[model samples]
Target chain A: MSSPFSSLHVVDLSGSIAGNYCSRLFLDFGAQVTLAEPENGASVRHVPPFDKDRRSLAFHHLNTGKRVVDLPKSKAELADLVAGADVAIVPQGFKDEIAKLAGDRCVCVEVSAFGADGPYAGWQANEMVHQALSGMMSNNGEPGREPLYGVGNRASYAGGVAAYITAMVGLFTREDDGQGQKASVDVAETAAAMCFPYVLQYFYNGTNRRRGDQDIPAGQVLCEGTWVCIWIYPHRFAAMCKALGLSQLIDDPRFAQVADRVKNWAEMFDIIQDHVRDEDAEDVVSRLQEAQVISACAYRPSELLENPHLAARQYWDGPDAQGLPRLGAPFRLSRMPRSRVNEVTE
Target chain B: MLPFENIRVVELTTAWAGPMAGRILAHFGADVTHIESPTRTNTWRTNKGAPSPVNYPDFDPGERRWDRVFLFNSQNVNKRSLAIDLKAEGGVETVRDLVLQSDVLICNFRPGMLRRLALDYESLSKHKPEIIVAEMPAFGLEGPHSSYAALGPTMEMAAGMSAAIAYHDGKPTVTGPSYLDPIGGFNAAAAIATALYHRRKTGLGQHIEVSQVEAAMQFIGPEILHAAVEGKDTKPDGNRVAHAAPHNAFPAQGEDEWVVIAAQTDAQWQALCAEMGQAELAGDPRFADVGSRKANEDALERIIADWTGAFDKHELAAKLQSAGVIAAPVNTPHDLAHSDYLRARGFYAEITHPVAGTHPHPGLPFHLERAPGDYRRSAPAFGADNAHLLGEVLGFDSERIDAMVRSRTIADAPNKEA
Candidate 1:
């Protein structure tokens, strides 16, 4: 199972969530990872939900399975680690600190609140700033209403991960050039704009993307309790009519034909919502799934973690130190390719 | 193999962030597997994959057609499935063995579940020093509310998305689900690739953890940084901008039918005023500067709407755009798929799902050079590749695999309820 480029070493110098996750990816794929810690140990260890030993469960879960280098008060040890470092995950672009350490050899992938050279460069920011500035909140809830953020710290993670990948691109490029270069990535609140849909509409049309309708032309503006950010396409569209016991929709003028339906999609959406309201969330979803129409529950974290398919998929274990047990890679490799589980000797 | 193609990744993750991280590696051609148990299927029932209950019956295998919609099929292509009973002893070792032999191990467990299974960072490192482990949750691995439960909405709200919408002028609005999951995907992919790059340099594996809430917040930097720097609230401008005039989504003849128009320059504004047959309006002082126009958007919108009321949204959008005014129809998913530009860009690809039949879904957002990017196969069934993976990757004997399966350690189906 060894890869031809299996000789890489990745050192993760991060505190809590974002940067560490970036490094763990390298660690998982057969790369050597060195988890460095400050003299006080990981700040995450003191956060909360301590184990019986009073150690942070969340910290333990994210920081396990790696050797730790306690930074000296002299700050020289940090320099040594950076000198040997290939990629450094600095969410806020600690350029000066990283520059002194990673120096010439290392590539610094700095994740910033805005961008490196923006009007808001030196401004202090976190997840909240990023989400709001991206204009995503504009279309999130009822039209002409206040904006809402995501259910999770999705922006920080998004910036962190996007920054990490950008670092990889630098790495890939370095491979061809046989030279390493430092890259500054600005993962601001605008970073996730592409995923919001219709960038062209925004760029060319001056469209405000943050509005949601309870029942609009194409879909419903859903508010299903806690899992707030989810917009749903009902399962009973004419295409899925056969699956929803409403096969008659396939022949109905308004409901029949993808083309015709597209023309009257707004009215169609409202009509679909009328039927959807009659059914409970689960029933509507299950029925729609059966019919093969695109329908989703627009779930929240708890609902997602509690899914039977996730259970059936064995995707989670239990709540770990971080929050809840989660799924990793989504596939299975060969287990009979002479695999052996190595246990470090006591 | 060039890198991780020969490497096996055991993904014990659900939802989008974590699973998608592994899915990307799979796309790069890794043997990524998913773990499942009967009780673990409750996460994102509507958003993830499932059977279409209306057309397909739940109990009847014939009626139990698989849920292969955009979200599921988009991420899960080219992966294998395995059902595991993590509570069982042999099941624990099975994961450990899988980790030992795997090139990468990805999981999105909240914060602490790895230790209970003895597969935490410390545990796995003992088994395989160079193993990559990734973790993502509602928040980061640390914080006051790190352990709290939330989906994309809650996270977005926590990140201040509600505060930013400011459209209604007072109450906060939440951005909800729009880009939360996909943002996680993009960031997770970045993190995973960075780790891989680091490993390529160090030969050492590390633990990577991400907080979805934090990740999503980064996108709203304008407000965040502005508030931080200016100590002022960035109010919502509706569809308008701080520096532009006549910017907004104007209503059309139909409900949910609208056109977004931005006249950034004087010439653009002149063209718009001409289109309205009110060429004299552009000369008015009240609508001269962007500031003047901002103060008079209501009357301006009324004027624009009156002009727009007669034409099709798409037709008008095209006409305005052709005039060099930034404009396009605000599209729905169906409209998006059928769009001429998107079609020309090859934004959609049709493929046959093992259970869901032939359909199109949004393909890769990021592309690589010299890469043949296509959905190689539909998502694998539960334990669909158990024997094949066990035999081909782990080199297990048939008797051993059969015994393990019989023992209910590594199952092709749910070995036990969570």
Candidate 2:
């Protein structure tokens, strides 16, 4: 059966990862987000992870619960749609035109790469470009090298979050005045600016913050070809060590104090890696959890789904008829909020 | 601007997350009273030590005013800061009274801690029926690992991004970006807004509980789905494009500068190749198809990079754009602050700070043509509107205000991190 979100009278005029990403949130929540195509479809149509049919993976991921309207909705039609919409989520550039078209009927929220007004507003950007621009890349990755780019568009995701929230605020504000209002969200590099606190310390704490190296894994041990990281951060290290048959290490001088161990992490890691490299990830993961350590089994995307924790949560709603898997909402209520739209009759 | 101009929002939060929700309201012209602890300076002041997140090493070799460059000022524009420690005597009731007259309550402490402080949903609902109470937790309010310790890195790793964000040839990396925190901040704001919409329809406020894990996990949807189905191995590809060829950042003319160029159709590639006077290369069998081009990316990258290396990034960007190729320079903070295009579009706005001088700061991301005016307030002083909050919201008398100040329960002044 088709999902509910495809039924709403929605219009999505977003490009790259940011605006499209944000609109997808509402789509998954049951908003009928129609990919409002102008001359060409969304820009990410060119981006990869494209389907077997050669459709952009970026497009597939974000537009899963939405429909694509090949023709652009006319201004009058756009206004008519918004007149009845509970919320209108638009990216920043189209805000002025959308608000003018919709007048006061729709609650308008716009998303942009940087802030609405500033010297850098019109700079061209996508995912990696914005990451560096946002000051996030500076704090990520390793030392003595170019800052590594994050997989998936972090800045874009941040912008999506910004857009989703801004629309909601407009939704609420519409209540007091009994009229819909306009709210523009500064997304892109501007929104991603606040994504790191430690990065801010580089500016604040007089410390130079750069990406760390592949050689020195933060708190992990180098073993063979892989880096074996121990599950003993400052907060819950003692408990994790107990399950590893290494409880004595909690009191051992080499690993005695959290501060000391942090200071001499490289050497300490060598000792730890020697012990745990041969141990299975499942065994190590289970033992650490049994000892009450807040630990996780770090794996690639494929292994993550098999994780015991996610399975217990039943996080997926199961793959739809299209053969793509689906995830649940990020926020949950006991009553459970229904997806705003229902299955399309067509 | 100031979309909620007349609406009053009461914020019971500290540090980052909850205050962010309040900031969003304030930015759009909501009258937000930030409830703080009288005795403790805003914990966010620690970042007060820097210039901006983009500026790497703030070494004041000489004493020149750098600026109050931190996250707090940007997140806290146009809001009222009022101090009232809930841990102190009568602090809980003081907040309760404010809630009665307010539209929303935002707090980002640990799950049960808010309840322990007597500032939970049940208590606030008593004061106002339609009062929306938003609770921001590091983890969810329930679950086995509910009461866990966390920060940005922890959350980034927890959400399956740490392993997913590795370099193509190297180990997994952590960007140190608070992967889901601000998203959590944004989600809290959105949830509060949606609930308020429901409340408007039904006249009932809601209890919004947002978890950082869920926020982080939201981004990991493809992976989660993949695991849910075929259970495949999805690792880092660095900057590689799985389905497209010649999609990588090529070095541009400045220190550590680069430009990303990607194209799919043969026409776009023909256009790019023609622009570079390398149309002959596009017809080569090795790069004939998108798949073949992606497969031979290293060789293709060399050809593209060599061409890009000669032209100035902007000129190359313009040339590539004219050719229907997707391209943009990897902008640094300096480039962002000073770009002419940003200035022309009026995307950045300048706000005079209490201490810092007029430095061009970023502003609202979206603009409405119907009412394109100013959003109210600038980055305010800590508890700058203490009197307004206490007297107006709680109906505190002059004597009571002075008594609270004397008792160190409230303060109109900041600790002066400057």
Candidate 3:
């Protein structure tokens, strides 16, 4: 089968996860990506968890299938590649340069920490700061405690996802007119969108959300042995009572209405917690699932890698240099087999 | 006026994840028609007579409450609604007929539920071999946990994100709201577009599977990959970076107000020190360089916090940024909503629905200089376009459509009190 991007070429001038991952998505689409890296290679190569050969596990996962080009390429050589390519994935700072080189046939996607031309455009930030600045950290920890930042550097990946989406829209537009466009995706805005209706509600009600801000306390509940984040939607009140075997609480006036339930959430959580303290997390989730209430076991990274469902769906790309499975594309396409370039070449 | 002018998407998704993808497609100009039935009205639309948390204008959901849900209105814009009870006798055939004319199909049902509905890829492809079907399951289609149901929070837990980002020394905690749902939706939309590109070239339609769990993993890919390679458990370290000093959210003057400051470079560190009126601190050996500063991050944090505590967050952010140090106020929802830059960029779209009234909706996240995404229509009311889509687009006669509607095979509202 012909790949979606067989004729497409990409100049990946991104060093970190955001731009690299965007290029990786293009690589998966069968576009030939030439990663432009510094003389010592990209900074990601030096990140932790290296193989015996000292190759970064992170770098191997994102860059294995793409070709690497040393940076400081002669302006003419770089311009030649950009002129013929379908996409140029660059850092926010390099937007104008890439745009000039791309001419009219190549789409330029600039992924930045703030945005391309914001007051904070020249500011330095990474995942941690982006999280803090985006109100994500504000809603992460317990009340009275200093806010927490989510594990894993997601701010950058969100930027990458935004870049990918923008690139696709650009390409789709180009499909008709043969004209390319420029796209700028700010990591902060992308992170904000991930929070969804919360952001919307805040705008509607003028309330800033905080950690433990829900009507019910949300966290890992230890069932017999597993940990799970049990969602407690107001409409599922009866189902939850049945699932937790607290059916008596269903008619209690303190928990009768959504507003009342929210007001008495702390006490209600205590009652529910006391009942489930001895049960297994998986067991509790099973009961909840039976009642059509939402719940699941809290997964560790190792557990996720070994998850049977992922194996069944072929969501891993085989062992990397260190004999660890690499995460596959976030989505799967049935007819066109996954590029599987690294699995074959590595 | 958008990129996907000729594309048509038939959505069978409910709740946040799948519908969000449909929303994006619609925003970009795809003719997205949401398939619903009285039996399976989306939970977002069937808010049980209660004042939905998603209500707009801060008003009670009046008589036509189904059409007033904030979630439904926000997510279903630029899309039409067609209520077809696939559970009805002829519903499957009707959808098959519709599928034959559409370019793409999307659903987020549990893995086998679609198969049970005879709406899985194999069955749908039988009708139109060149149809792109995007399936977003909470878990992947074939995993042991595939059958397990998950909302956004649970999936975040299962993806190890909850555990990884907890309070310092606390157990794993859920982030605010259903964080991964939108991310999953965005990825699904991108995947669908990519598949459409493939179909355009090869004249083949494929089944695209997006697992919310896997999508969450991609967010923390390098960290999880590290855990796999290093065989070590990772824990949440609040606001701490491996190589940056002064890399924490510091308290400001007001309650819960904060400014995040990061001084990664020596020049930035000097700038920060100068702004704090402690330029001499730049000469201190303990915090002289990135390595030393990271080694003594605790001390650096306290010192910075002490200076930051006396100032308002907004002022501190401005002062730091002007000094060439990276800083930004921890934006509340109001701050984001009222952002001058965001407003100036036309990032908020005000869409007016008859029942829900007018409200601000987020414009497209990506800025495409040439065909920017815009709202062409407000979200449709339940089954609002059943007659138009079935009769006009699908060429179904009014007699058949009316018969289906009378049989409870279609409805504009929930068949039972939802």
Candidate 4:
């Protein structure tokens, strides 16, 4: 039941989402992660949504399963501390200085808004800027309006995921050759990497796909008292027609082919909407499931809390420093034991 | 030499998420053998599941349409494909033999489907005690929704990600791209790598399960934490941070061109004002500090937009960045496809697939100076490695391989129905 990274030690000098989460994943793998915070605590600790007692939940979720230490005030002290570490995740701002401090045994992972040597590397950036810099905002949210970033800090989270993978790759390399190498991630590039073959499509054909509206009336619509999303492929559309007692609609010339359905999508949606207007949400869901249609009920956050599936899986971890329920491990390993230090961020 | 040169992976997966995980493992130098049923071809290879342009290299799928499918081809590089029918008489033994020789096994079948196939972790572990099984189920294995089927969009909704990502005043929506799929894939790859590391040390294998729903939650961790801690629900804030002023995508000259400018700190604000030739604005009471500027955000945006409207987004971003103010163009495919920055870093590799010809593909997200990943091999054709895998790796004689092929346990093409 020993964790994968049980033998490793880490010094984390990352501030915001990306570097911090990278180190946190290492912590989850049982690496002895030392969160090196400034004297006043990390910037996330001071961000909003504070409780009546002024504790930040962002910090509560991010700083679990790791011990905190005051970042060394001087270069020599920093060097002394990093000398014993197997990995050091440093922010772009302090990458150079930290790289010099990290010993040969330690791998230095630099996380940045752009990259280490890009022209935009020196510019200050947040999650939104990165979303824009990448093409994420272009294909997200409502079309024609100002581009919108997603609700959460997606760019930073993606950057963190990239950094963690890079670190693991580095560890894998080191395991063979006994050489811990340097790795880095550009937040913008990381976001772009997740983008569907958009760039490839653009390169192949002259098409710049724009952001479509989130609630495309045709794709997601209200069925009775519940929101349900439908991915209407030709096969699924036929099945949906059967489920809604509109079997004849499948043969209708206006909705027969994919192009015809696209042209008359509004009418087709209305017909489907009318049929489900009075049906129970659960009934609609069951009918669609039975018919093998590509459909899902739009669940809200509160509804997710009550989902019998999530409850049975026990996905939520304990109340951390701010007494907030945090998500447990992103993945589970049957034999590898998870962290038991639930009340961290001290 | 590649970092994962010694690693071997047996991929039993379908669609984007699972294939993407196998693709990454291949990129990292794992000897991945993709096992698909010839009778039940992966959905991505049939019909128009392939991505644009490359799917039809000369604007045609030619003779081997499945091999040319861009979606499957793009993610299946550097891997061998083995088409084995699990339902066939000798199919189970074919897979079991491959499993015995593999280091890691991966699958994304619905919760109980693998167990029904008698290839679940428990069943596989009994045969190969050192096998690392990475299971990526849509909802997860032991849940009420576990038995329910899903694509990325549905899983996103089930995970509450769609709700959180909606516009401030709009309904929750789905991304054009399945955003959570790649994230889940990346997590799966990382988990397998870590598990491999652990196995190397302890000589034991473990069952690793990565739920698409759970992995999606990591992106919205702060919001969930806030709601759980302070009973405060976080509303969507489109392109704007609470404390950062001038933090939005401002219009530029071209049709959809825009630039994001964020003056997070006082110096950045001063620099932005100076770059816009409105140094006097920095001294204005309404825009003096973070709090005041946030309060007067509308007015600030108007003034900033007026200046930004005259120049192209990329050009303006450069000017702002030179002055130490935060700025970047809201780039689309057009801009990204021809990016000088990406080119300078060698971010894109020109990979030549047999059917797709040559095209630019994204390199690894991170750079490893010493032992970088190798993208030498193109995606395998349907059951391309059947001869080599069965004859060489399994040490099977030609007669045995021929017999399996004759019985339809091995296939060179998808089933006639497919």
Please report the candidate that would top TM-score against the real structure. 4
**Over the stretch B126-244, how does candidate 3's per-residue lDDT look in tens digits?**
87788888889888887566778777878888887877765566667776557788878988988998887777668888899888778768777777777776676666577676656
For candidate 2, write residues B1-418 as lDDT tens digits.
3556666787766666777777766766678887765455555543234333343223331222222435556667677777666666767777777777788778776678768866677876786777777877765676554665555555566566777776775666666445556667777777766666566566777687777766667665644554444445555666665645666667777655666777756776777888888879878988888988888888988888887876666667766766677666555454455556555556456666664334444554444443343545555665678788788767889998888788767765443442
Tens-digit per-residue lDDT, A1-346, candidate 4: 5565787998888887788888888887788988888998798787554656787656666677678888889978888878868888988767656766675556788887777676665767777777776777787666666776665676788788888888888877777767787777877777777776667655444457676522232376676656777777766788888887889998999999988998899888888888777876656766776787766777666556555667788877665554556676788887776676666677
Can you give the lDDT of residue B372 in candidate 1?
26
Estimate, for each residue in B104-141, the C-alpha lDDT of model 4 and write its tens digit: 88998777776787777798889777789899987788
Ranking by DockQ, best first?
4, 3, 2, 1
What is the C-alpha lDDT profile of model 1 across B1-418, one tens digit per residue? Answer: 2234565788887766666777667766677887665345524223234433322212222322223323444467778876667766667677677778886777676667776777776778776777877777665655434454455544555455554453535334444344556666566666566556556666767676666654554444323433432334455544555545776666666655556676766787888887777889989988886778888978877888788867886778667755666554545433444545434434456656566555554544323232223566766655677787677766889998888777776664432222
* Candidate 3 chain A weakest lDDT stretch, 10 residues: A211-220
The second chain of candidate 3 has a TM-score of 0.93
Report clash pairs, candidate 4.
none
Pairwise lDDT winner, candidates 2 and 4: 4
TM-score of chain A of each: 0.69, 0.80, 0.84, 0.88
How many residue-pair clashes does candidate 4 contain?
Answer: 0
Model 3 RMSD vs true structure? 3.4
TM-score of 1: 0.59
Q: What local distance difference test score does each model get?
A: 0.53, 0.61, 0.77, 0.77
Model 3: DockQ against the native?
Answer: 0.54
Task: Work out the TM-score per prediction.
Answer: 0.59, 0.79, 0.90, 0.91
Per-model C-alpha RMSD: 14.8, 5.7, 3.4, 3.2
